[model samples]
Target chain A: MSTPFIITKASGESETFSLEKLRHSLLKSGASPETTEDIIEELERDFYSGMRSRTLYKKAFSLLRRRYKAQAARYQLKKAIMELGPSGYPFENFVGEIFKAQGYTVEVGVILQGHCVRHEVDVVAENETERILVECKYRNTPGFKCDVKIPLYVHSRFQDIEKEWRKLPGNHHKKIQGWVATNARFSGDAIQYGECVGLQLLGWDYPQSRSLRKWIDEDRLYPLTALTTLSKSEKQRLLEKDYILASELVSSPHCLEILNLTARRKHQIQNEVRQLCGNGD
Target chain B: MSTPFIITKASGESETFSLEKLRHSLLKSGASPETTEDIIEELERDFYSGMRSRTLYKKAFSLLRRRYKAQAARYQLKKAIMELGPSGYPFENFVGEIFKAQGYTVEVGVILQGHCVRHEVDVVAENETERILVECKYRNTPGFKCDVKIPLYVHSRFQDIEKEWRKLPGNHHKKIQGWVATNARFSGDAIQYGECVGLQLLGWDYPQSRSLRKWIDEDRLYPLTALTTLSKSEKQRLLEKDYILASELVSSPHCLEILNLTARRKHQIQNEVRQLCGNGD
Candidate 1:
């Protein structure tokens, strides 16, 4: 932060630790621009050369923690998202809810007959005008990207399902679409291929303004994994029971009894869920 | 044997059962040329119209079974190959042994570091001149084919591993190669893509002269699943214990005790293993 100096990265590699990079990371954590600038400038004056990136990251995290709880939580957003997976079913349900919020009737885990065989489609959201089949690609880490092959696979599959659909008596009336949604980003080729094939894609920050994050944020439909009150196993239990979103937890608080949580802990989780979803009731 | 007419297939679909097709199949089963022709000719006169494929299959199976038991076993090659899977590890180990028989040192389930991350390659065989990385795509049923996408995925993975190898201080000397071996056929595009990219592909009968079946046949290294003496659970146990090849079973016949077979059954299994591996002594 101070005078730009060299530091050791987590990859056991060396890089110049830039103030701009720190400021950008801070801004991403939801720090106010003015405060981010002030913190960076202050850290720079006090900092020494040859620092480890981990130490620098910790220092920034602590500063954000002291400044704002919400910003601190936002800093851990990637980790929170990652906690939702290993299986993408919960993410599929969450995406389905987002579509449901927008007035679409959603079905999760629909098995449709393809040309060659039957395929388990993640989400099917339909309204009077159209039906959309969505494939949810969930990765446990941010580093993994959905590549061209996924789009190719999905496009081929969509064609098969579409072929089978035509044989049904009244399937021709509604417009049908195929979509691939991922919490992670798509590789460059995936985006290009999907665009070329007219396959809709919605990744975390992809297509900029109307991405998966935007839909969830707008609807205030945060997944249970986003709650700090839930442990990894607790979150997993909730996800296993198909309680995907925080709003869903509020809707069926009775399900918490199966978790065998302490009375105090259950109350705390309920309070957090209500606060996160809204205080409308 | 009777003359064949239209027959219902395994898919419950109907097709004309041809004499030439039957002869080809018999020859593929390793039947003598004279007997194969005679069997087909004899069957043609006795067969009826509109027979189920299973009945025709059984008639041929009985004829071959009576003539040469070993050939009958070979005739069940597709089924035996299928029995090796659901998980391709046993098949992969068998492939490793095939390469081993050809005088290469083999490693199975080798986790190699790739450029982005690490990948667990099914088999890695090395000789003085070259090192080969093999990916075994095993399917439980013959209906599955290694499609164009598989080559694309394997090639991408190979490239990543190759990139990492280049970064290693002194890995340039050994010629590195990547291959994909499946117990089934490759889709047209898979072969096209593999040939175009110079990624070696060895499917059951792909690439003409050099196929997985050819290798196994040439080496006399049939998998344990080829033995009829073992039940499904017994074969599974053998596979789980990593006794992949019939030759391995012969070398360690004592391992057969855990299957809880009658003395006659154990003796029969041992005899088959010995015959299959050509260990007459």
Candidate 2:
């Protein structure tokens, strides 16, 4: 059979796999269909064969992924609830969502390493003069008997961030202060740790009633819509799992057959079932 | 119940969970007597009071994990069939493992942007003169037909790596070549892509007597003895799904339990069966 993408076969008569055909195949394989179209359009515009190699396509895909991720983050923030020790993403979302509700422009999950890769604070809120680094912890259980380990770790990471901020290129060196937020109440030791480190600690009892009037007036917080897309079911599901499963449930016929056969073979089936259910233990 | 290690209770007196007292509890939990001693020692090292911090312990655990991973990689290499495609890791393991195998010692997963992040090519073997970008692909199938996307993507990544390599600091403007080894063979397009990008393609070809000797002499291969400590039964169970799974299976009680269940379910007490007898999948 002729290859789907039409190109002049060695016999050399002007033939080509229509860009449209390439897109169709990518969609069939579960690729982001729109991505293929846009990429094809861009590639066609710059199609000098092998002049500029793979970096061009890599950049295109990277842009697409970043766009998708940013949009998802925004959508999630609007619908987030009082997330308890949530994983990295949800915790950041909660912090940004809270700030948005109170009218603050917030950026979540920015990488700041040692000077460049130091600490990755969950959320950073900026108004005009002041910048707030909000570290959010989403816990499954909400209790005051919090683990000292989590806060201490958070504190160490914060210290690293502070050290980096001290070296910020511009005026940011003076505008930033760190704050920690958690769904669960903090232990006294954690508060002591925060106090010792000169960081603000905001547990479940952060003064949510005041609405951060200073933040609003100074435009420290911008009013962004709370994430409205999160379904209650999705939120509940998020609360239940500590980790994300890399693979989606494969509902293909092959998977079904394997599951059926393995299920019948008790020992292997048990292992398979456990894996399917995410019980690595 | 008293904690496993010494805990100065709320009253603040020196208290200890003695070995003799803990022995009964350990036995009840099905731990062997020898295992109990190991457990107590570990618990003693890990235990702390006054709002215990687990970060240090976690760091220790993480260190152990890294050491175990390095050891595991060595073992897997030893068992690697000389002709197995790129060392027969799963399609996903291709790049990362090869990079690890070659000592790029950097994480490739961090740069991967795709749906199959679990299947990543993230290892780069780097030195002053040359850098080999190793992308591993482990497949259940034995042909290269179904597994071209990865090599294609990896070839694309290599192009990106080359572009980035030019921008690196100092006088180190070295070229980074790519190698892709998969348990499966390459599809026509994958091979074409590899060729287009100058990737060294390692496909599955059983080593002839002469080839084995060559591999041993080059010191480019891993020895099987150092790859794993799994029992024969465990190895058989893992190899059944994808022969590549032999490298992925971690020996633990859970894995053993799964194996036991699988065997019992496969043959309901028929004729006597050897524990490790099965054709490698």
Candidate 3:
């Protein structure tokens, strides 16, 4: 494009569309450099000033999908994570799996007694040296950022729980940590307060190299909802049965039997899951 | 009234109906003892097993309304306070008015910088020797309790603000306090945490003698929405214009001019406000 094209963002603010940013995202989705360049060139032909960023995203996503299903699914990972909730339970479970992947024994949705009161902690992960309490702030809306109130509340809750934990026998040496994880980004104040209070914050694109998105991509721990082969209802049923991660179905194919799918369709779903998770031979 | 009737409360818990409780409430609404007994007797005739307590309340309210409009309004104060919100702004303003009635100079919905971050406090009140920051938790739904998280978060926010307040040149001698006010009741844990951390909690029926209800009644600071003479839309318009209390209209009768209400209707509203607020000389 000769002149800068102003595109409306999800937040209703307009910014100049950058070819370099789009190219980087496409490449990050596992597309080849040539493929990313080709997609960007095609997209540039249709670019118009004042077009919505959502429309541009849909166009790019469809173009990517036509070339590779797994890459497209990976590209839409953030959106898929959002689809996990009208309720926050699924996201909490997803965070639990991430901790489990990192070799911690994780518990999802446990009510533990704090020093002052009982707190319903979203995820608790424990290893030999340390125990972590996670509070998940899930917002399904695009561009919704977790603000300072979240980290402030999470810090107090952790302090209460940590105090009680420190008093228990055989817990004298174990380090206690608080974490605030979200599928969305965190406001500047949220990060400042969280870090100042020694709380770990993991947002979709935060912490630079070790965000929630990075953690998911690191282990191919894609939520079941990210499988394009599965119907929405099919994925929801799997989620209801607590089959949250795609890797779970790959490891235990018997879980798919609950869906009562035809042999061919079941095989197709298994193939897609394995391919997407990089588990297929 | 021969066998005890089971009534479902708003929380969906069933309890045996108490005649003494009903009688006490009726008498408390400014009804004469004889009038209270008459209403109870009439209500007992229609009572059945497995009836909702809401039905009992409605029946008593309508029966009381037939005798006195002002008393009936007082009887429905809790529900009226709830009706002040689909948004919490009106409730916050009502809270400000309550603090004002207690002889404090108050600011509603003010954003003050905390030691760590800025906070949008619901109501800030100051007197010669004290400053109080209040967080109003308004729940439109009946039977919703303010859980421990509410107070835990409020206390942290208060601490952050208090830290900054302590550094202010003239605040050294002023007693800075944090308060959580709710239209709903607080969970036991919430009250415990709040009190443990020196935060004052005011709920609909909490602290026994000095609850939100008692405060409203102490000065006859009935919300404008509690005036039976005003329609919902009329009250809403007044609320939108920041005229939140019936006493607001009593002091500035000309505020009614914005509603374009008829002169007779205006006089009727003023008369009811005066009678309800005990300001009818």
RMSD of candidates 1 onward, in order: 19.8, 33.5, 16.2
lDDT of 1 by residue, B1-281 (tens): 34436877888888888767777888898888988876776667657777777787678766775556565566677788898877777888888888998899999999997655466799999998788999898888657889766875677667768888888866788889989998888988677767766889999898789787777776777888887767889999988888888777678878887788888888888877766667321
Tens digits of per-residue lDDT, candidate 1, A32-111, equal 89878766765665566677888887887676654554343444656667888787777888789889988999999999
Model 2 backbone overlap count: 54
- Considering only chain B, report the TM-score of each candidate against the true chain B: 0.73, 0.39, 0.76
Cα displacement (Å) at residue B75, model 2: 13
TM-scores, all models, native as reference: 0.46, 0.26, 0.73
> Candidate 3: RMSD over Cα atoms?
16.2
Model 2, native contacts kept: 0.00
Docking class of 3: acceptable
| Tens-digit lDDT track of model 2 for A189-259 | 56654665566776654334432222222332211222122234443453344211111122222322322
Candidate 3: segments with Cα more than 4 A from true spot? A1-67, A141-143, A259-267, A279-281, B1-67, B259-267, B279-281
lDDT measured at residue A113 in model 3 versus the true structure, 0 to 100? 88
Rank by TM-score (best first): 3, 1, 2
Clashing pairs in 1: A2-A44, B1-B43, B2-B43, B2-B46, B2-B47, B3-B43, B3-B44, B3-B47
**Of the candidates shown, which would achieve the greatest DockQ relative to the real structure?**
3
lDDT tens string, model 3, A1-281? 65678999999999999877887888888889988877777788888888999999789867776558877788999889988988999999999999999999999999998888788999999999989999998999998989888988888899888888888999998888999999999999998877777889999998988998888987899998998889999989988888899888879999999999999998888777877888431
